[model samples]
Target: MSDSPENDSIDYGNLMHDALRLLIRNVLTDVSENGLPGDHHFFITFDTNHPDARLADWLNDRYPGEMTVVVQHWFENLDVGDDGFSITLNFGDQPEPLFIPWDSLVTFVDPSVEFGLRFEHHSDDDDDHDPDPENDEIPEAPMEENAEDDTPHEAEVVSLDAFRK
Candidate 1:
């Protein structure tokens, strides 16, 4: 047998990434069929510049690189598919449609349950470059309960690094 670089062997990283993205898809699919259960809400962050991502021109211009969206309180027409999902969200009472591909997701969080996932984008050319720390940060979910409650709950984010060997 010929020797090969570990990275060239079984790619657990990509496997895990795909699995997590599927999890998000499944969750969204459920929510699309039946509205968010209890106080469960999501804070989804995605790369606005991703080629597959579709958003309003003004939104792209305002957010530039990345934007975080709240999937609670006032979203409409949530449609989940095998590869991505689309939904209409309100921005200052202006409803705009957004199509976010699963691959463009940077982070997904449900602070009510204190659960989250962070995805790291890897590319052949990115092998030598360090990951952007900013992308690692999961945005805090919007208040899903009484505004008087100021307690903060930390999310248990599942990072692939923990499973890497």
Candidate 2:
């Protein structure tokens, strides 16, 4: 067998990203089918500028870049699809529906269990800067207080730096 680097090169980064996204999808699907079990909740951060991300005009205006949503107490009509998920959440007592694509996701965290996954943001137009492991810290999103409790939750994020080259 010929040992060519090109022939043996596999896109592990993309593969891992896809697998983690599938995990998110599966979790969302389970939540949609059977509701969040135990004290489990999710802190989902996504790109608001993504083409497939749908939110109210006011929300878009308010959070033009990225937004983190807590899927805990006040959520409804959760629908999980192959490519994405849709759910209704309240904003100042006004319920609004949002559709967030899996590809648009930046991070997924379940602070109750201290489990988290952070994804690298790739832009087609961004070709100048290379991936920097040092700058890979997950960005904090504005979190709403849980209705049932006043205590704050912090996610223990898992960095994907070691797997990168």
Best by lDDT: 2
**Which pairs clash inside model 1?**
none
Model 2: per-residue lDDT, tens digit, 1-165? Answer: 548886687766677777888889999999999999998888787777778899999888777777888899889999999879999998889999999998777679887776778665444444753445455454455632212211222222464333222
TM-score for each candidate, following the candidate numbering:
0.74, 0.75
Report the Cα lDDT for residue 162, model 1: 22
RMSD of each: 10.2, 9.7
The alpha-carbon deviation from the true structure for residue 148 of candidate 2, after best TM-score superposition, in angstroms, is: 35
Global lDDT of each candidate: 0.72, 0.73
- Report the lDDT tens digits of candidate 1 across residue range 22-141: 889999999999999998888887777778899999988777777889888999999998769999999999999999988777778777776777664444555654455434444343
Model 2 clash pairs?
none
* Superposition-based RMSD of candidate 2 using all C-alpha atoms, in angstroms: 9.7
Question: Each candidate: how many clashes?
Answer: 0, 0
